[model samples]
Every structure is written in C-alpha cells, then in structure tokens.
Target: MSDAIVVIPTYNEIENIEAIIDAVFAQEKAFHVLVVDDNSPDGTHQKVIELQEKYPERLFLEVREAKTGLGTAYIHGFRWVLARDYEYIFEMDADFSHNPEDLVRLLAACQEDGFDVAIGSRYVKGVNVVNWPMNRVLMSYFASKYVRFITGIPIHDTTAGFICYRRKVLETIGLETIRFVGYAFQIELKFKAWKLGFKIKEVSVIFTDRTKGKSKMDSSIFSEAVFGIIKMKIRSMFTKTKPHA
Candidate 1:
C-alpha cells in the first residue's frame, strides 16, 4: 500500500470528480485518494463508487450524510487514514483549480526534503494565479498578507487548500479542536502547526479558476477567515497547544 493519501472533499462536484480522480492516478508518484463526499446531489459519490471497481485499492470514499464544513471533512479523513499506516496526508480541492501535476512537487517537499508541511502556494512567487479577475486576485493575495500579520505565520499563502502534511504534523495538531469550518479552517490548521514549531515549506504552484463547475467561494467564507484569525490568536495565548516531536 502507498504511504500517501490525498483527502479531497466534494459537494456537487460531479463535473470534475471523475476527471480529477483519473488525473491524480496519472501522477508519477503513487498517491492513494480518499474522497470525503458530502452526498453530492449531482451523483458525485456514485461516480467514485463506479471508479472504485477499477482502482479499489488506490481510490477510497467516505460519504457524509450532510454538507458540513471543509475542515470537518478533512478531520474525518485524517482520523480514517490515521487508523492505517499512511505517512503523508494531503488536502486538495475537487475542482481543477489545484493542478494534479503539482502533487509530485508537494510530496517531494516533505518526502525528499525535511519539511513537515508543504504548501502549494500561489503568492509565494508573485501571485501565480491564472484566469482570475484582478479584484479576486488582490483579495486572495492580500488576505494571505493580512493573515500573516495577524497570526505571525511565516508562510505566504496561509489559506491555500492544496497542501501536504507529514503524518507527524497532523499527529501533532489536534484535529478535533480545529475551528472555523470555512476558509478560516485552512488558516487555523496552519497557525496551529506554526505554533508547534513545525517546518513548513511553500512550493510555487499556479492556481487556475475552475471552468467546469461553480466556485464555492462566498462573502461569508471570506469574512470567516478574516475575523476568525483574530479569535484564534487570542485563544492561543491562554491555551497550551502541543508541539510536534
């Protein structure tokens, strides 16, 4: 069995689910994919079930009863995968926004190098984003900057969903205590890892806007990320967070 598992959360992603699964399998490096589907009404889970017949060992699925937050889906994936012996765990989007090709680069950062966490960063190298409007681009780029100033995390893209975490990093950060089920959820995980003194490396990756499906980004999600960081920082002061070994 492969040591790496990429946890992809899905909700009405039928347009891209089958293609993304095939793309991930096409990667040179072996990576097992776990689709945490939120019972996509568009039959996303059915597509995964059909493909499982072909790649049963490499592709797995966990269908949730309702649409929860992205953070909760990943937490479920972490617990499910951790029960096994996988060393590397990944979080990626079902949309084509996050390229499957970059999976190799992300895995390399933690597998070949000594970094505990690897991020597929867009702002790390002059905002490497494609097909996004200037305003949306600015909002995302500056959001990372704002998160850095507020949380003191050194990484450029704190809200990047395409990420790789060594088993030790996930094992260090308590998945149950993770707050903010929206965009802020991404920031919360990174902040906890930083506070624990884990090594984080950002590898440059181009984020393309998904053309096939609707975007999940909403104003409330952005607001949650902006305000949630402040509360997280305040809580960290009074709380005793555990560090990785």
Candidate 2:
C-alpha cells in the first residue's frame, strides 16, 4: 500500500460517492482511500463496496452504525489507518467542494516541504470561495478570525475540512482526548497540533460549494463552533500545555 491514505467520511452522500472515489484514484499520486461511511440510507457505502470490487486493495471501507459527527468519523479513520504503516493521513469531504487535485499539494507540504499539517485553505491567500452566499462567506471568514483571536492559532481558514496530517502528529495528539463533534473539531485539532509545536502550512485553494449533495452544516453545529470555542480556550488556560513529540 502507498504511504498516503485519504480518509473520507460519508453521511448520506450517495450523489457524490462514486464520482469522488474515481476522482481521487485518477490523481497521479497513488493514494489509498478509507471511507468511514455512516451507513447512509441512500446506499453510499454500497456504491463504495461496488467500486472496491474493482480496486479492492486501494479502496477500503468502514461502515458505521448510524450517522455520527464528522469529527468521530475522522477519528475512526485515523485509528484504522494508523494501525498500518501509512505516513500521510488526509481528511477530505465526500462532496466536490475540495478539489482532488490539491491532494498532491497537501502531500507535498508535509512530505517534501517538511510541514506537520497541511491545510487546503480557502482564505489563506484571499476569500477564494465560490457559490456561497455573501452572509455565509462573511461568517466563515470572520469565524476564522474569531478563532485566531480567542485561541491564538495562526491559521487563515480555521474551519477547513480538507487537511493532511503526518503520522507523527496524529500519534502525538492523543486522539482519545479530541472533543467537539462539529466544525469546532477542526479548530481544536489544529490548536492541539500548534500547542505541541507542529509545523502547519496553508495551501491556497478555491472552495466551490457542492452542487449535488446536501450540505451537512446545521445551526446547532454552527453554534458549537462559534460559542464553544471560547469554552475550549478558557479550559486550555488552566490546563498545562503539553510539549510536542
């Protein structure tokens, strides 16, 4: 198996499952995929099962009981892939919002450029998002800024889901301690990595809102990311910070 594995979490993403798997495989780099499907009612896992028949070794599946949070799905993927000898682990969406071509760049950031975490950031260069409403654009942009101000994490797109982690970073982060099941989970992971002095680099990429599948974002999840971050920050102040591995 290749050292790089892209872990994609799916929840009712049937519309985009097959196409996404195909796209990832089409890339020049030989990256394996681990789909942590939440048993999508629409048979997202079944589609992956069908595709796995053709590329059995490269494509892997982890069917979950029911719809769980995105954070937990990724955590499951992390543990599964970590058991193996893969050096680079990636977190990507089933939808087409994050371009598959950028996976090479993310890998390069870690393997070639010597960074611990590489983020396919939307705001790293500027607001390079398309098809999102103006309000949504502002909210997302400001949310990153808010997270930076409160948590003191130096990232342009704090809520970006498209990310790559070196094996050592995940091994050190104590995956069991990860909290927050919503978008805040993204921020928390980055924060913990930064606290431990992991080198993180942001690669500017345009985010095109998915046209096929429904969005997973909800008000409750959004609230957790917005207000919950302050609580996370306060807790961190009292707790002694751990050094990097």
Candidate 3:
C-alpha cells in the first residue's frame, strides 16, 4: 500500500468514477483510494467493486446504508484512514472538478515542504474556476472572503473540498466534535487546524465545474456555512485547550 490515500465521497457518481480512478492512478506517484459511497442507486459502489479486481490493493470501498450528509461521510473516512498506516490523507471530489494531476503537488506541499495541511485552492491565485455561472463565481469568491474576515483563518479558499492533510493534523483536530454537515465542514476543519497551530499552505489550482452527474451543492449548504462561522468563532473563544489525539 502507498503511504498516501485519497478519500472520495460519492453519492451517484457512476459517470465519472471509473475515469477519475484511472486518472488518479495514472499519476507518477502511487496513491491508494478509498471510496465512501452513499449507496448510490446508480450502482456506483458496484462499479467500484468491479474495478477493485483491477486494483485490488490500491482501491477500496465503503458503502453506507443511506445518503447522509457530506460531512459525516468524510468524518467516517477520516476515522478509517487514521486507523491505518497511511501518512498523507486527502479529500477530493469524484467528479473531475479537482484535477488528479494536482494531487502530486498537494502531496509535495505536506511531504517535502513540511506543511501540515495543503489546500488545492481556487482563489489563492485569483478566480481560477471554470464553467461556473457568474452569480455562483461571485458568491463563492466572496464567501471565502467572509470566512477569512470572520474566522481569522488566512486561507483563501475556505470551502475548497480538495485538500491534503498530514495524519497528525487530523489526530489533533477533534473530528467527532465537528458539527457542520455541508460546506461549513470544510471551514471548521481548517479553522480547528489553524487554532491548534498547524501550518497550512494553499496550492493554486483551477477548479473546473463537473460536466457529468448533477451537483450536490444547494442553497442550504451555503446558508449553513454563512451562519456557522459566527457560532464557531464564539465557541472557540471559551475553549482554551488544544484538542488531543
């Protein structure tokens, strides 16, 4: 098994699952993949099982009974990887939005550069997103700005789903106490990591909106992120001790 593993959370991503897996493995670096599927009716998990025959050791799957939320799925994945021997853990979309080629750079940031967390950021170098509506681009750009102003975290892309984390960062941050279930989940993890004094670096990457399958994003996810930051900031003020592994 490789020292690094990418955790992809999927609902109904059959259209892109096979190609994405191939792209990740095609990289020069060898990285294992764990698919946390939400029992997609489209037989997404079944496809993973079939492909597991091809990449028996490098690819794995976990099928949940029902579709919960995105946060819970990742939290589950975190716990799974933490129990194993993997050193570098990643969060990526199964869709092609987060390029597989960038995974190598993200790993380099944490492994060779000694950063604790590496974010595949879309805003660190300006607005590098493609195929998104103007309204959405504006909303996403300003949302990161709002998160920075409110939480005092210096990250440019606060809600970015593409990320690489050193194992210790996950162990330091209290994963079970993570509350938000949508985009806010991404913010909370980064905020807690920063609060615990983990070094974070953002690698500039272009986010191409997915062409296949429907988007999981909705207004409720955005709304939660907007309001959740305030409550998270307030709670942090009272907590004095850093979370233990």
TM-scores, one per candidate: 0.98, 0.98, 0.98
Candidate 3 steric clashes: 0
- Candidate 2: lDDT over CA atoms? 0.93
* Ten contiguous residues minimizing lDDT sum, candidate 2: 236-245
Error of 1 at 84 (Å): 1.0
User: Residue-wise lDDT of candidate 3 within 4-38, one digit each (tens)?
Assistant: 99999999999999999999999999999999999
Candidate order by lDDT, decreasing, is 3, 2, 1
- At residue 68, give the lDDT of candidate 1: 83
Those runs of model 2 whose alpha carbons end farther than 4 Å from true positions after fitting are none
Per-residue error for 183 in candidate 3, Å, reads: 1.4
Error of 1 at 206 (Å): 0.5
Error of model 3, residue 128, in angstroms: 0.5
Compared with the true structure, model 3 gives a TM-score of 0.98
Q: Which residue pairs in model 1 clash with each other?
A: none
In the range 113-144, model 2's lDDT, one tens digit per residue, is 99999999999897999999999899899999
